[model samples]
Target: MGKLLIQGGIPLEGRVPISGAKNSTLPVMAACFLAQGETILENIPEITDVDVVMEICREMGGEGEWLERGVIRLHVPDTISCKTSYTLAKKLRASNLLLGALLGRFGWAEVALPGGDNIGTRPMDLHIKGLSVLGAELKIEHGYIRGGVAGGKRLKGGKIYLDFPSVGATENIMMAAAMAQGQTIIENCAKEPEIVDLANFLNAMGARIRGAGTDVIRVDGVSELRGTRYTVIPDRIEAGTYMIAAAATHGRVIVENVIPTHLHAITSKLREIGVRVEEGDDQIFVDGAGLFRPVDVKTLPYPGFPTDMQSPLMALLSTVKGISMIVENVYENRLRVVDELQRMGAQIKIEGRTAVIDGVARLSSAQVKASDLRAGAALIIAGLMADGETEVSCLHHVLRGYAHLEEKLTGLGARVRRIS
Candidate 1:
């Protein structure tokens, strides 16, 4: 594991180009199996999670190579292995997405139960339920999800109503429904931008998908999908993380190559906290030198405050001059970072799903450990604004999502370096 040594008290300034969305790229990469021939994907983020997904793809007899920076050429085989090893599938939660693509193409899939961040209890019941509704027999036996259509049958699409707007379930079902026998109607689906991106990628490859950015998503099954060149969307969570880092340090940063509409929830919150956010065609300029006001935040489904951003936003709130309340409705254990923040002079209290933060004048440096991906990001934001040097350990968590994190922070004028 690597560590990040950061000297605080520098206002980040300059343009930081956002990387491709990890959430979007993972599913799109898995969707490559739905089609044969070479499928080119641009704007692929160089992150551990993406690499892991690609490794899984290669293990299944598919070929993948990086044509250039942030570009990948993937060649899907006519037939791929139906089983994914536990060692590979346990690397990330996105591995669950492969089940849909594999089942859609091969009528069978045996994947291990996924392992990712320890944020909360992320159950696979929804994923199993959705696929079962689409005519697949699924069973969890000895930490593996073994699923297949009996008698070499293809999945037949049907109506699936999610108990919760689970993004993983929505993406998994959509990928399976893309090549199913008939139309699939998914109600109360997640409306995240990544979901829309996956839908667009599948559509480019000849899948009839509609109502992506809404609660109701309709997927008209096709016989088979063809290969097509597609580009992933910018990482909104990464862009928001940088925006919050800039805001915490009272800096000015222009986050480029992002869709402004996708960040309305984040930008509006920043403005509410007295930060200046100016939106452009594909960029957002954040100026955070003004006095910040404490605001209440509630994490909800898409078009609302994202749960992934709760930790970093809370770090920003730690430096404000008043009390703030954050309600994390998405994940139960997301408040795990509050203890680490408190070690750095933050006044915080967690009561069930709610967190009460009493903002202080400034925070002093401390040796902190990151427990999860977003928690690592929150610690980085805190380190950037601390009074002295801060050493952040467990950097592997951060590298799982953010691409070129230290380099990007350096480009923005922050003093940050990786220590092996």
Candidate 2:
């Protein structure tokens, strides 16, 4: 909808607050369907994706509104629609979560195939397999994923083993299994912090779940769930972005409102690169004015280097000395940002899923496009380090994930402004 014009060569120095995790908030909003009453969710980020979820909830006969800044008051009636329209569902990848929540609540659900960033093919097979094991007769009919229990029977709990520990699959199955008739055990589950947040919120709403932060999770089905207030964890992806941005600009920054443990992978990488990283109880300080070294990064499931931070990390590596390699073990097309970075004088070569980057002494300013959410963050970081003004287009993708991006960067003393 707009573009960000940023002047480069200024070291940012200030405090930046991380928002509530978008990954956590979306699934938690879908999980709210299982509870029939007013559920107050605090620490909600004011992002467009939240608006999309609120719209989807209303379309399904649930009512929600912003009670105040960073707060949402949602009320789900006893009876609600079990189908989500393609127009709404296709706007967000997280819409697939409705399949499990609706099926768990009403034994029937019809949701369109999801759409979000076109990084690569993110199959729904894991989600389908996990739900099928729990006794939901799901199938892809026409364009929508539709089906449920055949005989008006509640979903029966069973054991499921995911070949890949997909975060979405883990969350969908967990929500559906929460209302099943017996205990459900999911082995090889994703152990992300967002998964733990979802489990905590569900447990607060009277669902019995344990071992959430581990590879095996146990969910004891409950007859019904009541509404409750819950706060989501801070977004580690956002926190990592700011941390990398500080290092890329040679700025000293303190990122607040974060769980230091959730960012272990990011902090470890920065330290290995010779950046000064100091961790506090709930914050992290990064000093970037030091000699930089090269390091290799490979994306993996939780507790590993997150794919979301891959682009931003590459942006930092582009300015380092020597050669650095990045292997994209998560999404195949996520390296699309390489073309834009190359326009700014970066030397990078892609071989299959791996990127071999040769550090450049400096990057000149150039006009670039943001192909996706994280890619946009990478471009912004590149702009902050370049010699002149840089214009970043495709602003909608950036707005979808980041909240108050220009304001936050400006507060850090960077010259950033939004233009149409």
Candidate 3:
């Protein structure tokens, strides 16, 4: 059992480096299954999700070990197995990534359904539909998602129009298509940076991937893929959460080792709330300007306001000047964090899917629990803004995505300490 004890009202000031994207590293790790030899992945975040992904690979007859702080060396044998462990598969939602990797390498797969932080119902129907398009036979029995790609079956690539541009579906489809017998075009594909990172990883492995950071992507199937070293992109959600922390606590902080393009949405929204955001080539500086002002925001897909950022943004808005309305377009139950925020005396009301947040002058210290990953981020920001010592439980959810969050906040002069 672990908790974060945060003393509020400190002006967090200093530089904090953002770690590798959990979103990017998980799928990149999954793509190692396509390789026959050793692959080196750099900037791998030391998070719980990565541990789960590593276990998945180890169970699938692959060997992996961390060479450096954020580097992983993995070797998937020439003959890979299609069967995966049910216990490992269900530990992390990203384990479903094995479907495409297994299909690409062995043309078959049998894995359990994914499980992780319970934000909402993240159905895998889109993944199934895209796999079916890539010529896979799938069936749901009991609690497992069983599928095979080689029952005298040919995965001939074709045009796939997704009903929704879900990120997971797009990545899985792209991975499978990269090894198909023909060209594959995915329409309305997810344009998230994580998807682009996955594309870059596949391309590095001798797969032809084009137009990744767009609505449509094209993949030309190759006979085989070779292993190579890849560096994962920095995490934008972690950067956004720290940005909100700086502004909420009336602090000045510089977040480093980030992609400026990936953080455009979060920076734009923060500036709207009177927080000063200065962007450099690989870093961003945020400063609280005297008092914060309220700003209305709506969560959308990539290049728009991201759903992953809504929680931290809500925490910043809790003590701003006026009321702010936020519409969550991505997840159905993302507003569940509002209960934890209310524990700190923040006035917020959830109506259906939208949340109306009334900013108060201050938030009193209170104990709160994290319901999910992003919710943990929101609670941490709330603790940073509270008037006294605030306690946050469920540090496991926070550890899943963030890497050394407490240490970084401490560098920024925040009174944050981890208690186990």
Measured on C-alpha atoms, candidate 1 has an lDDT of 0.93
TM-score quality measure for candidate 3: 0.98
lDDT tens per residue, model 3, 1-420: 589999988888889999999999998988888877789999988988888777777877788888989998988887756777888876688988888888877877887888887878899899999888888889888777887875655577988999999999998999988888899999999999999999999999999999999989999999888899999999998998888888888888999999988989888888878889999999999998665677788888888999988988998898887889999988988999999999899999998888999988889999899988999999888888889999999888889899988778888888888898
Instruction: Write one digit per residue (lDDT tens) for candidate 1, span 1-420.
Output: 999999999999999999999999999998998997789999999999988888888888888888899999988788778788799888899898988998898899998899989999999999999999999899999888997976678899899999999999999999999999999999999999999999999999999999999999999999989999999999999999999998999999999999999999999999999999999999999999898999999999999999999999999999888899999999999999999999899999998899999999999899999999999999999999999999999999999999999889999999998998
Higher-lDDT candidate of 1 and 3: 1
C-alpha RMSD between model 3 and the true structure:
1.2
TM-score of 1: 0.99
Cα RMSD to the true fold for all candidates: 0.8, 0.8, 1.2
- Report the lDDT of model 2 for residue 123: 94
Those runs of model 3 whose alpha carbons end farther than 4 Å from true positions after fitting are none
Score each candidate by Cα lDDT: 0.93, 0.94, 0.88
lDDT for 118 in candidate 1 is 93
